[model samples]
Target chain A: MKDQNGFDELARQKLAERDFTFDPSHWTAMEGLLARPGRKRGAWWPWLAAGVLLVGGATIWITAREHDPAASVTNPGGGPRAIAGEVKGVNGSAAITEMENASYGNDHPGTMNADPAVPVTGETRATAGTMRGETSGEPRMRTEATRTRKEHGTGTSDRGTVTMQVNKIPVSSISVRQGEDPHAANVRTGEATNDVSSTMTGPGAAAVAGDGASDERSNLATGAVDPVRSDASAAPAGGGTHGEEQPDSVLQHQPPSAGTGPVVVAGSGDSASTGATAAPAPVDPVAAALVPPAWLAITAPYELTLLGGAFSTTGRYTGVDAESWPARTERQWTTDFGLEAVRNFGRHFAVGTGVHFSSYKERLITDEVSRTEQQLSTSYFWVAHDTMVTIVVGDTAINGATYHMTQLVPMTINELGVDTDTAYQTMVIRQRRSALNTVSYVELPLLLDAHTARGRWVFGLRGGPSVGLLTGRSGSLPDNSGEGYHTLNEVAFRELTVGWTARAYVRYRLSAGWSVGVEPTMRGQLFNSLRNADLDRRASAMGMMLSLSYRIQPTPQP
Target chain B: MINDHIIAGCVRQEPKAQYELYRALYPMMMAICTRYERDRQEAAATMNQGFLKILDNIGTRRKEVPVEPWARRIMINTVIDAHRRNKERKAMEGADIDDHAEGTSGINDYLKDMEAEAFAELLHRVPAMSRTVFNLYAIDGFSHAEIAGMLGLSEGTTKWHVSHARTVLRNAIAAEAMARTEKTVSR
Candidate 1:
């Protein structure tokens, strides 16, 4: 019984030893840990870091795209006005005044002063105006500016003088489009139903002008006379000029309006008008050619762009079957910035090219006994040129409003700094440089572009499976040991790499001609055998990029 | 069990609670971070992020929630996020887990003889990956399922890694403890 008491006491002491103590020093050590934002050279945290960045990046992208709608809703031409000039052309009286100035030589740079008594001669050929030689420098100037009207082209030339000069192109518009269907049935044409065609070119001395509008409000003043008013033909009180005989009249059999005809052409906004067929008519022909009721309305452009994000990659490096040594793999990532250029052709079929560069580095030690190893990478110059084709099947929306699909394809060229640091633990090893690889591939850029009052904003996940053909691959690698990887004969990459290329891009189009954007990318090489080896070792990478671009526009009614 | 210590430690930004909690948990937490981290900076970062949380919500700890898990979750996120960020750590279909494990010397038996503080210090010095595997498998009573879930891996991978980690750590700690014993005897 007494022995049991001693045993019980021992058990009690063991139980008491469990203090479950929390150490103050633990806090000190942890304080530093606590202060740290993450782990070091972490093999585990990169995934989570990628997740956070993805989420954050996506959020930022969304916010960036969303900001455009509120700013552009009220003003189509929200930017500064870039045009300046009176709306109307001078009439007969003004034409006479201009003729006087031209003859007198005291007139400003461009005042029409041609005599009104000139006989009419209709001709479809390039115009032929009699050159009036002047004694002062003005005569030489007039001669340089002078163009004569003669005759040619079918039998349409008669009483009107066909005047031809540089002018603004115009668009012929129908009605509002139903949706984003590019192949939607064509809207019915006006068919001279309302006599809405622009003025015609005349046979005699003809004058045609343009109503040019620009996106930027040009603050730079001009030293020359306004081209619109340079012609002596006086503008009507209605502020527009129309001609009786125009190119369109040849296609039609009806008589055109005198000086107040309306200008409306389908699909084209050509505003130039001529009156070479008026003969003895005193009516202001220029005024009759002017188009009526300007239509400056257009549906916003919708688009979606999926560029390469930090999660996307292109080039890869991995180890395959080497029985003597364990198979090893390593991937290099671009540490600096990147860029991508995309071009779209047709609706679902498009092709584009891009240039990319980054730092790549990785070292491998496969055999412990032989101690054979090498660092096969660099960080100076890298570029990628790639091409792709894609079909966008969906629409992008903002606040439930649908936007048009903007698909693009890019030819990507990757430029990288090639470098290597190698050391043999037990045996000597040799190394060589890899020739700059110019890989060509095809990819699809899918985008969700929203057309808002502020213009168009885009965000998308762009990616595609592609085939890469190596256009250039020539280099050398020397070995210290009898065994060394060669850039060409002994070893290097395969001739072709089948892989996944992807990117995420966000953009805001400020106007029909201008836009701004940023993109992040990820790329990797496919499981292509290296050095003629039958084994497949695939490599991958990820990064971010940015860019700015512009759109070429056809002269339009919008 | 001072009321102030208990209360301060439970409130976020409560200095006394933060101080006490920091003092109490620093070593253990550091051991945890180092065990699960790849490098000191990474471990420190996780730990730092964790500590900030502890400071911000020290007031809440007075409740019934477990402080260690709450802190560990943050560190786990940091580690996972960091790992994901590494371009090298891609998801390949097949990653051989057991083909090349080196046999370890037996050393886990000494847990009974050492103090918590001493053991914690020793654990701190062990390679973080090995330490984390050991702690999760041995002390924390985590199964390969739980480990794999936390580490974002397959169960087989978690099991193989834990076994390998245990072997290496056992050999390392045994040598260390033996050296300590020799030093004491010599003194």
Candidate 2:
């Protein structure tokens, strides 16, 4: 106790002793570690924000592109709205200029519609006719499906009103404003039946008024007459007299191409002015198929992924028990490859199936030792007449006294107690023996996956059971000490194994269709790898898997 | 000065607060470094290396524990690393233990008579391995088993080094006292 106390006290005194004054210069050297160039701590949030913004912008661009085709079909002008107003001036040619000014703008001058009442003829007129099914050869059955909407104006009284018809069929009510130009008072109402007068106001009225041009085209084909000529002839008639007499005059003046149907022309210029009419042509069939189907409106939600990585068993053989020691188990890296197809039910949940090919290896190493020994046995010899003679050691015992000879005569005893021998030998040997076990398997996995996208990254979890069949198995026993180690086969481990696998992943979207991801998976076989063993030893594998996924969308319906 | 806030500032590697922390813990850490390093310059280098490690890994420190002990642990580990690097180079040098006979002087008497700097001079007389082992095992509150693992030596070897360090220091102190008394008598 005294020695221990003395030593402790002396050690404490020695350690407590030092010159501890501070030097200001030492600070420079220590601070150099923090100031090393290019060693700045990187902040990840800014990069993450930039990536999110980039991905968001790309998504918006892609969505806009998908809707671009349908947009062009409806709005041919590329402007906000289409205006189809027409006004006839002093001459028939001046009528186009007046109509352009009234519909578009005063400054908007155009010669595209020089003859405003010339039936937008040929292909456009024929297509419009076939759209409503009202051509010469076709039946009037398309009229029953057409629903006309009525438009009411500020004035309810029928003043200079003209009842217009197209393709010899009636649609719905059309009312003109009393103070407005009756020549350019052509207003078309769609199936919505909402009053168009509220929308028809100011310079923009022509813009909003053209919104229902589709319905007007259908109505134009319903009357079985020349639509533009009827509208033009109706432009000048102001009174009931012109309204009553215009149909007869227009019917007499119209050519055979304009059909023999009754036409009504009303305007404020004179009693009844008949306009020129163009003939309708045959409808085109190719244009009918260009209409897109309802099913092609949405994007597809299936994903295909290719997975490749390495996996290893998280198992070690500790020689059966803690005390029973022999060798160590070392496992090699195994290759894993898979192809997965997932069908997404929604944004968050999906079901998937995949085929996987994988292989694993393990080696058991043991230390070798050896042993050796020696032994001796007795023999009998006889001499006769100075000549040596040999005899069998057990012959005299079986014959009793038959081989006995006195004096110099040869005698041999089979039971003779004889010689002893000993040998000294030293041996030193140490060797290492190893056993290798390899297995390859094919598995089919059915899994339910769930995922969510945040900015450019997608986080997901997928897990399910797989039916694994052992395709190949090979094993080698320790060569020198072969008795200590035994070979193994697929039957030793079950040929068919049912195992569960689960993985969590983070994927970065590379493009709209392609994404790259890394997933860490944990898998374990339910059945034991070794049979007839007291302790259950199941092989479990855990590793990080890298994958590239491609999204496959459904083709646009014809 | 060595509170949670200064620890946090050091974790962020802010120079102003790191300077404050350095000035606060300078004396004690210098004492630790000086015991392990023979030269004052080498001790400064070791202490700075230890401080750099503390700042670099300060963010990982547990919040419940005081920062001083964690910093001290880094300092001790740094000193051990220095000892290991110099072990083979200094193995040939041996202590001259026959310079003084054993004397019955108490540790208290030596402390009362000598200043800390004077005691440090006597500690230099002990060999390097013995000195480091004593500092780590006795003063640093490290167990013989832990010191063995840290220095990669057997527990018995660490115990022997501690005993040998004590014997060398005691003899050196006794020899210094004898010389002083003789000089006073001659005067």
For each of the candidates, the C-alpha root-mean-square deviation to the true structure, in angstroms, is 33.3, 23.4
Segments in model 1 whose C-alpha atoms lie over 4 Å from true places: A1-323, A326-361, A365-456, A471-489, A529-531, B1-187
Per-model TM-score, in order, reads 0.27, 0.35
The top-ranked prediction according to TM-score is 2
RMSD of model 1, in Å? 33.3
How many clashing residue pairs, candidate 1? 163
In model 1 chain B, the worst 10-residue window by lDDT is B90-99
Give lDDT tens digits, candidate 2, residues A131-234.
12112221111101111332111211112212111211111212222122232223222121111111111110111111122222221222111122213232
lDDT of 1 by residue, A1-558 (tens): 122223223322332344444544545665555456652222344456547555755674544333321121111111111111111111121001011000001111111212223322211112212112112211011111111211111111111111211011011111111111111111111111111111111212222221111001110110111111112221221122222222334223222211111122111112211121111112222322221111211222222222333333233222233333321223333343333344444222233443333322333323223444554554566766576746475788989999777567555757675666564445534332233322233322232222112125544445565444543333332232335544434455566565555555566666555566775555566566364453333546666656565554445576
Q: Which stretches in model 2 have alpha-carbon errors above 4 Å?
A: A1-3, A10-19, A42-558, B92-103, B106-108
Question: Whose lDDT is greatest here?
Answer: 2
